[model samples]
Target chain A: MPKVEFNVDRCKGCELCAVFCPQKIIKLSEGINKLGYHPATVKEMEKCTGCAICARVCPDCVIKVYK
Target chain B: MKVVFERPRALSDVTTHYCPGCTHGIIHRLVAEVIDELGILERTIGVAPVGCAVLAYNYLECDWQQAAHGRAPAVATGIKRALPDRVVFTYQGDGDLASIGTAEIVHAANRGERITVIYVNNAIYGMTGGQMAPTTLEGQVTATSPRGRDIKQAGHPMRMAEMLATLPGVSYLARVAVNKPANIMKAKKAIKQAFMVQIDDLGFGMVEILSTCPTNWGLQPAKAMEWVDEKMIPYYPLGEFKVPGEVK
Candidate 1:
């Protein structure tokens, strides 16, 4: 199972993960979080391979991956 | 694939305490890999600074010292002078290097000290609640500069690499990032070059890594990398800032 979590407040809205996501399942949300940045969302969790690549490339650590 | 991503021998088995997406873990691995590859793990002495990486001594397997806030350069200077044959490097952060230790770094480079400095410039201070740092960009908001860094009030971001490259004593200076694997490779090369310069008895060498402090910069892990690419790169452009004795 691929599981991802984001600490919404920590996100700074850089969006590097969206560019690197192999499955392209992640996207920034339309609504702003407490940090005033659109945090990433895993719209299609089935496509995730649990590679944690998105988590790895993120600089903010807002993303957490669990398999 | 038996084990391509195993930890380096120079790194201890203790799991890193860095926050998720914190590139400090990756940077530590890179340093340990270089130390292992150079066959200097036994002779290398690393100096840890007072920022997020203050506990680096705990993770790195080689001999280590914990220096006061922004004093890693001075400590490394002493260690190198006392043991010229050993490899000495200081791992420091933006706050440690660009702020309180500015004079130390400047004098160390100016004196041409035979040491290597791994300067991690994440723009904001990671520890102590994400305060605005000297490297924080203009209009880049932080805990201190909530309205964004005001050039009129806070002055402009400091370009440590460009500033030190111009000093006569600095023999090698480069700025690399860890936003991606390709960039990580570049950072590794630069790090190796720094240590190789030290081994050759070359003068001062420093590699300023434009790292992402996702926790401090108020960005998600992925976005922090994006921020690095979109914002940080333009201000602190990467490349060899200074390299003396080149054939070219």
Candidate 2:
């Protein structure tokens, strides 16, 4: 299984990662962060390939992947 | 667990001030990753331009110099000449480079300065609000050109990579965009190659990265990324215009 971690506070809630995710697992949290943006989080970690595509498209570099 | 992808050491942990969906952050990370991979952080000196990316020095941990508006190439040239052993590069925006610092870049490339240049072209002045830039597409509405950019008055958008490729001193010149995941990988490769050219002591190398300004473009971050594909790419096609020993 692969793991993806996000510095949620730094996320700009641009939703780019969610759109680019191949597995369609990342989603915005129901709550907002300090910046008042709905940061993205993984909904189904088991499906992630750890391709880092989410991280690559992130304008804020908020995600890191481990495989 | 072993780390497959993480932040690059060459990039500081400081949160950038770029607007939401702005691709400057993506481009910055690519450069930092290239610096880390090339093991040139210690010798890398970057010249920061006067635009939205002016705060680049704060995010990139390299020893950086602040260049006067539209003089990043000139400053980079001076730095490379003063420290020939060091790897010097300039990061400039479309407004700063294409509009204000055109002569500086033309001369720097013609002089064959052994330096890397990361040119971010968003086609609008992002820092001081959305103003029409030298690379703005024809009929694109912006703050300065509310009626849309008039081709008669503004002329066509400048294809800087191709224009700079004409110089005999150029070692490498490529135009890459950061609109999607695949393009991001290609952009990283191009940026790394540009730095390699400098390290190999080749002539001036530059990578013009088609970037996004979501706030200025008045579109979602993702849509702005698509704008690069649907709007910008047709006029400024992506390709390696020049390569060392390949072009005359």
Candidate 3:
């Protein structure tokens, strides 16, 4: 399965990854992170195409994609 | 599993100080990615300017020097001359490069300094709480230009890429945006070419990246990217303004 990983601590809850994800699989978690902001995560691992668009538009460089 | 995308080796493993949606981090990542791809991480020297990106040394894991407001090109010139073999580049914002550091950049490029300039033109002074900048578009509201930029009062916005393209020393000059994935890819290519100009001992090279200031723009992160496409791009049109060999 294609996968996407988030360095939760580095995320700023910008939602840019979610906004750019072609599959719309990235979402912000309800839980606050180390910096007190919601971090983005993959909503459906199976939906990932490993396009890496999320990683490309992430302002904080929070996501890494694998296939 | 094959990794499609990962952190660039040239980037530092640390959180950036940028706001939730600022595009500066993205630009930093692109530069780091280019450095790693070109295998110039070991010899690259960056001069960070006094602006929102002043702490660029924190994100880009390389030998860096902090230049005073708008003096990045001057500092970069000194570094390049002192260590001619090293790849020297300067990362500066519109407030630093277009407003305060205008003379430094003009002279540096005019003299054909073998240095790469990564100019981030977000239009407004992002770190200074959205103040008006030299490149701020006409009729654009900002902390300083609350009523919108009046062309009569402030004159027209500066087209840094086109203005600098006329310089005889400029080896390469291009303007690109990072609002989307496709544009970001082109941005990376321009950045790589800018760095290559320095490595090849060509004259001054600059890649004017049209970035976003989401916090100051008072828009959502996503909307900010859209604004770049809807507003900034039309005024700034992305393309190569000058190429080294095609001087004619």
Give a tens-digit lDDT track for model 2, residues B148-200. Answer: 99999989999899889999989999999999988999999999899988899
Which predicted model would earn the best DockQ? 3
Minimal lDDT window, size 10, model 3 chain A: A38-47
Q: Model 3 segments beyond 4 Å from truth?
A: none
Candidates 1 onward: DockQ, in order: 0.12, 0.85, 0.87
Residue A2 of candidate 2: its Cα lDDT? Answer: 87
Candidate 1 segments exceeding 4 Å error: A1-67, B246-248
lDDT of 1 by residue, B205-233 (tens): 99999888878887776678779999999
Q: Give TM-scores for every candidate, taking all chains together and pairing residue i with residue i.
A: 0.81, 0.98, 0.98
| Candidate 3 C-alpha lDDT tens digits along B1-248 | 98889999999999999999899999999999999999988899999999899999999988999998999999998898899999999999999999889999999999999999999999899988999998889889999999999999998889999989999999999999999999999999999999888888878899999999999999999999999999899999999988878763
Model 1 has an lDDT value of 0.84
DockQ of 2: 0.85
iRMSD for each candidate structure, in the order shown: 7.1, 0.8, 0.7
Error of 3 at B91 (Å): 0.3
Clashes of 1: 13
